[model samples]
Target: MTQWTAEQPIVSIRDVHKSYGQVEVLRGISMDIMKGEVICIIGPSGSGKSTLIRCINALNDIQAGSIQVEGQEVHDAKLDKLALRRKVGMVFQQYNLFPHKTALQNVMMAPIKVLRENPAEVEARARALLKKVRLEGKENHYPGELSGGQQQRVAIARSLAMRPDVMLFDEVTAALDPETVKEVLVTIKDLAADGMTCILVTHEMGFAREVADHIYFTDRGVIVEHGAPAEFFTNAQDPRTRAFLDQVL
Candidate 1:
């Protein structure tokens, strides 16, 4: 377990509400994510899990409330989006790699192009990140040539190349085949073991049990229950949470 001594949360969300026109997706959501903590969110489809994480990164807008990362309001109009993105990395369900670029180039793009980092230094770091994700030899291959698992690993390496303080994974293995799912999960587990602060919206209950320091169960846009894994998974008090666990577990 990580020794969490930070005086304030790395990410703080308070009284958040989101909607798509008439349909309210998130209703008064609130949570504090401490540095170096691994938080896993589990819930049924259409429960606003993806929307909530997207809000943290300011990829989606909220109707009310506030989200802050490292003491800066995420939705602030004057905020530097480039700097925010550099500090917070996000990986989606799809690999989303540029098919035209080699794995190495895909990992090197943002740092060199957006950040204007030195080409030589970016190349070195990109190669090192590829190795870190266990995709060392496939660096020269394009996304089309790699298997789904390999491409996803490359995507993870691309995210890591930014050296973000926090990582958000939104159902990263949802599109993968069963056999390939374990590979991506293993890579995420390695990151968590190294004390990376990660927030994941995942359906892999077993993975959530093993990797998560805290587990949150959301339903109908509200967090129904949350607690340390040992207590949340076994001694859940909310009826909705217990029912959901019965069906899934």
Candidate 2:
């Protein structure tokens, strides 16, 4: 893993709360992500793990509290959501690729359109990113032509093309076949090793144990337990965390 110099947090969540109509999904949640940190969020379905990350990028609006990325308030009316999104890349479980576009085109599209970079340069960077993910030869393949793992890697490459300071992954390997999960996990592990600030919501305890600097266990819209991976996975002090781990792991 790349050695990260200890410094100020790159992302901060302060007393954040979210609700969909009358249904409260997040309740006064707070967390901090330091530069180059890999934080994993694990919880039962509907515990607000996904909602929290979505709110960080303004994909989901919060009813109360604050989320800040790189010291800029994410929910402020004057804040530019587009600019914030460009800095905080996200990868979803469903390899949300443009089926009509080839892998390289998909990676190049955002940097060319959003950042307004040179097309040739963006294409070259996209190709290099694909190669980094071990998808070099598959660049010309459309999403339909690739397997689930390949498409997910392309989605990751697409996100990385934005050169985000922080990456949010929401159950990225949940939909993959068991045999295919390792490849995607390997790519993510590489990112963690490279010291990319990452926040992942996943059920893969082994991956969390192996790569995450900190693991949070959430329940009923609250972060019930959080600690280093070694402590959280093996010696979690909370019963709720242990129960959840037993059921899932």
Candidate 3:
């Protein structure tokens, strides 16, 4: 346990664990995500990569340990979870857009309903976010009308509308066609370039190598190895990490 200092991480997970009934899913996981750091979590399916990030955002409750976003304990009963959610935005593999709502409306829904922010101000920010993801004119289009790439970009914009301090992306490109994957990746890379604190669970090894400030290789619900891009991909310390990289890279 460490006290907050000048360099304290924005998101901190300490000995976190999760399970479904008796089957343990996360095994004593711990990590620190510094401000402006892009952390890429890579592993075989079911290795708890997505679960860890979900826990950080409190999308799923953990049985033990603690997670803190901006120093507020995520598991605290008295803490405002809705306010915490504004600080940590998440995008899933599925776009999860409201089919009834257009892109601009979808992005504006959260801030207006949850934060009670002014509709005019939220609309302005929503438009800018859509433009940032290269979907300026598509704001009027519904999710069903856009391509897979376009929809995912809208999802990104919807998340950014909250002005989150940390963004958790859970296998965002898995469902997209090969042709459309790059466009989504490029949109994410642009965010990384802008110094967003992002944690992405991705199978796109090359993109992870290019954009990640730190990389973690997990297995069986535990982090087996972690390091900078070059150090991790080139010289993974754990056998499981090496095996995973050998297969992916």
Query: How many residue pairs clash (N, CA or C atoms closer than 3 angstroms) in each of the candidate models, in the order given?
Result: 0, 0, 0
What TM-score would every model get versus the actual structure? 0.96, 0.96, 0.96
Residue-wise C-alpha lDDT for candidate 3, range 1-249, written one tens digit per residue: 356553889988899999988888899998999999999999999998888898888889999999988888998888798889888999999989999999999999999998899999999999999999999899899999999989999999999999998899999999999999999999999998898999999999999999999998889889889999989988888888888889988
Can you write out model 2's per-residue Cα lDDT over 152-235, one digit (the tens) per residue?
A: 999999999999999999999999999999999999999988989999999999999999999888887899999999888889
Candidate 1 C-alpha error for residue 241, in Å: 0.8
TM-score, prediction 3: 0.96
User: Mind giving the per-residue lDDT tens digits that candidate 1 earns over 1-249?
Assistant: 244346789888999999999999999999999989999999999999999999999999999999988888898898899989998999989989999999999999999999999999999999988988888889899999998989999999999888898999999999999999999999999999888899999999999999999999999899999999989888999999999999999
Please give the ranking of all candidate structures by lDDT, highest first, separated by commas.
1, 2, 3
Q: In model 2, which residue pairs have backbone atoms overlapping below 3 Å?
A: none
**RMSD in Å for candidate 1, one decimal?**
3.1
The candidate that achieves the highest lDDT relative to the unseen native structure: 1
